[model samples]
Target: MIRMENVVKRYNELIALDHFSFAAKEGEIIGLLGPNGCGKTTAINCMLSLLTFDKGEIEIFGQQVHPNNNAVKSRIGIVPQELAIFDKLNVYENIDFYCGLYVTDRKKRKALVEEAIEFVDLGKYRKFVPKKLSGGLKRRLNIACGIAHKPALLFMDEPTVAVDAQSRNFILEGIRKMKAQGTTIIYTTHYLEEAEQLCDRMVIMDSGRNIASGTVHELQNTISTQERIEVGFITEDQTIEAQLEELPHVVKVTKRNGNYLIHFEKQENNLPDLIKFMESRGMSYTELSSERSTLSDIFLELTGKELRD
Candidate 1:
C-alpha cells in the first residue's frame, strides 16, 4: 500500500535517510524497528509527505505521495508518539472534530465517531474532557481521533508506550482486529515483544538506513544466533559443560546458575539434536528451554545501537 524508492532526506549536514526504501502490503503490519535518532520518524514523515525529502520517490497505492494529495491523505491515519488532543474538548467532541475532517456529512461523521469510541472501548468517557480522563484513556482518545475516519492505512508510533499493561493489551488487541479487517499498519516502537506479537513483518533501521526487513523468521536468520537453549542441570559440572560444547550442533556453551546455556549457528531444529546428544552423555537436566533470537537481539546486533535517548 506504501512504497519508497531510493528515498533520501537531509538536515543540514546530517543525512536522515540514505537511499532508504521500504514497502507495506495490504492486511499486514510493518514495524519500523530502530534505536533513537535512527531516522525512523524522518522516514515516516517523508513517506506521509509531511516532510519533503532531499531526493527519491514515494508512492501510495501507485500514486505519488504529496502533501496536498487529498486521495492519499484521506486514506492514511497517523497517531504520533506524543499525545495530541484538545484538553478542553470532551471525548466525543474530540473524535467528532477529527472525524469531521474526512467525513463532512454530519450523520456520517457521527456514526464514525461512535464506531471509533466503541473500537477504543471509550464509551463511558465519551462525555468527559481529555484532562478528566486517565492517561491510558487519553492515549486511546488520541488514537480514536486519528483513526475515527477509518483510514485504510494507519501509522501507529508507540501507541502503547507508558500505558498500563491492561491498556497496552487493549491497544495491541485492537491493532490485531484492525489488521484482520485488512487495514495496513506501519507500527513503530522500541518494545520488541509488542512488535513480535503484533507485526507480520518488520525492518530494523539505523542511521537513516534499513539494515534488515522480513518476516520474524527471515529476519532472525540474517543474524548469527540460530537457536538458543538454556539447560539447568541438577548438578554442576565443568566436564559436562565441556562435553555439551563438543556435542553436534553446539557452537558455544556458557555456565550460568548451575546450568549450561548453548548457542548454535543457523540450522533446522537444532535443539532436539542437542537434547539427544545430552541424553547420550547420560546428563540430567532439571530444566531445558529453547528460544529463537528475539527482534530486540537482532535489532541490537544488526544496528549496534541502543533505543534509549
Candidate 2:
C-alpha cells in the first residue's frame, strides 16, 4: 500500500532521513521502532507529504505522495501519539467533526461515527467530553476520531501510551480487528512487547535509517543471542556472574536486583549446561526460567540502546 525508495530528509546540518526506505503490504500491520531522535516521525511526515524531502520518492497506492493529493490523503487515517481531540466536544461530537472532514453526508457520517464508537467500545461514553474520560478512554476517543472515516491505511503513533493495562489491551485488540477488516496500518511505539504482539512485520529504524525489517522470528534470528535464561537465587552471588559468563555458549551474564539474566549464543543445551554447572557447584536457585530471545533483546543488541532511548 505504501513504498519509499532512498528517501532523504535533512534539517540544516543533521540528516533526519538518510536514504531511508520502507514498504507496507496491503492489510498488514507494520511496527516502526527506533530509539529517541531516530527520525521515525520525520519519515512518517515525509510519507504524508507534510514535510518535503531532499531526495528519493514516496508512493501510496502506487501514486506519488504530495501535499495536495487529497485523493491519496483521504484514504489514510492518522492517530497521533498525543491526544488530538477537543476537550469541550463530547465523544460523539469529536468523532463527528473528524469524520466529517472526509465524509460530507451527515447521515452516512452518523453511522460511521456510531460504528467507530462501538469499534473502540466507547458507546457508553458517547456524551462524555474528553476531559471527563480516563486516559485510556480518551485514547479510544482519539482512535475513533481518526478511524471513524474508515480509511484503508492507518498510522497509529504510540496509541496505547500511558493507558491502563485493560485499556492498552482494548486498543491493541481494536487494532487487530482493524487489520482483520483489511486495513493496512503503520504503527509506531516505544513498547517492543506491543510491537511483537500486534505487528505482522516490523522495521527497526536507527540513525535515520532502516537498519532491519522482518517478522519477529526473522529479526530474532538476526541476532546471536538465540536464548535467554533468567534465574533468581536465594542469595545474590557476586562471584557467580563471571563464572556464568564463562559457561559454554553463554554470550553474557547480567545481574539486576536479585536475578541473573544469562544471554546465550545460538546453540542448544544452554539451559541443561547451566543447570548441570549449578548442580555441580551445589548451588540451588529459588527460580530458574528459560525463554527464547525477545524483540527487545534483538533491538538492544542491534541498536545498542533502549527502545525508548
Candidate 3:
C-alpha cells in the first residue's frame, strides 16, 4: 500500500536519510525500528510528505505523495509520538474534530466518532478533557482521535509509549482489530517486544538506511547468535568458560547473574552438545534454560550496543 525508494533527505550539512527504502503491503503492521538519530522519523516524515527529500519517490495507495494531495492525505492517519489533542476539547469533541477532517457528513462523522470512542473504551469519559484523564487514558484518546476517521493507512508513532500495561494492551488489541478490518498500519516504537508481538514484518533502519527488512524469523537467521543457553553450574570452576568455548557452534559465553550464558551460532544441537560436554567433565548444573534469540538481540547485533541519544 506504500512504497518509498532510495529516498535521500538532507538538512544543511547533515543527511537524515541515505538511500533509504521501505515498503508496506495492505493490512500489515510494519514495524519501523531504529535507535535515536537513526533517521526513522525522517523516513516517516518523508513518506508523509511532511519533509521533502533530495532524491527518490514515495507513493501511497498507488499515487505519488505530496503535501497537498488531499486524496492521499485523507486516506492516511497519523498518531504522532506526542499527544495531538487539544487540552480544551473533551474526548468526544476531540474525536469528532479529527474525524471531520476527512468525513464531511455530520451524520457519518458522528457515527465514526462514537465508534472511535467505543473502540478505545472511552465511553465513560467522553466528556472528560485531556488534562483530566490519566496518562493511559490520554493515550487512548490520542489513538481515538487519529483513528476516528478510519483511514486506510495509519502511521502510528510510538502509540504505546509511556502508557500503563493495561492501556498498552487495550491499544494493541484495538490495533489488531483494525488490522482485522483491513487497515494498513505503519508502527514505530522503541519497544522491541511490542514490535515483535504486533508487527507482521519489520523494517530495521540505521543511519537513515534500511539495514534489514523481514519477518522476525527471517531477521533472526541473518544474525550470528541464533540461540542462547543459560547454564548454572552447581560446582563453580574458573576454567568452565574456556571449556564451554571448545564446544561446537559456540559463539561466546558471558556471565549473567552467576550463570554462564552461552551464545551459539545457528545450530540445533547446541543444548545437547553442552549437556554431553558437561556430563563428560563431571560437571553438574544447578539451573539450565534455553531460549531463541529475541528481536532485541537481532536489533543490538545489527545496531551495536552503544548508547544513542
Per-residue alpha-carbon lDDT of candidate 3 for residues 1-309, written as tens digits (9 for 90 to 100): 998989999999898899998889999999998777778778888889888889999889988988888988898999988799998999999999899888999999989999999999999999998999999999999999899888999999888878999999999999999999999999987778888899999998878888899999999999999999999988889999999999889899999999999999976988888889999989899999999998888878887863231
* Two-way TM-score contest, 1 vs 2, winner: 1
**TM-score between candidate 1 and the true structure:** 0.92
Segments in model 1 whose C-alpha atoms lie over 4 Å from true places: 234-236, 266-272, 279-284, 305-309
Candidate 1 lDDT score relative to the true structure? 0.86
The full ranking of all candidates by TM-score, starting with the best, is: 3, 1, 2
- Which candidate leads the pack in TM-score? 3
- TM-score for each prediction? 0.92, 0.88, 0.95
lDDT of 2 by residue, 6-116 (tens): 999999999999999999999999999876678888888888898999999999999998788888888999898778999889999999999998899999999999999
lDDT of 1 by residue, 1-309 (tens): 888988999998999998999999988999988776778888888888889888989888889987788878889898988898888899999998888877899988888999999999999989999888888999999999989999999999888888988888899989999988889999998777877888999988888898989998988888887777899888767688778778676768876666677888766768778778879888888898887777876877787765541
RMSD of 2: 2.7
Q: What local lDDT score does residue 297 receive in model 3, on the 0 to 100 scale? A: 86
Against the true structure, candidate 2 has what lDDT?
Answer: 0.90
The reply for model 3, stretches above 4 Å from the true place, is 306-309
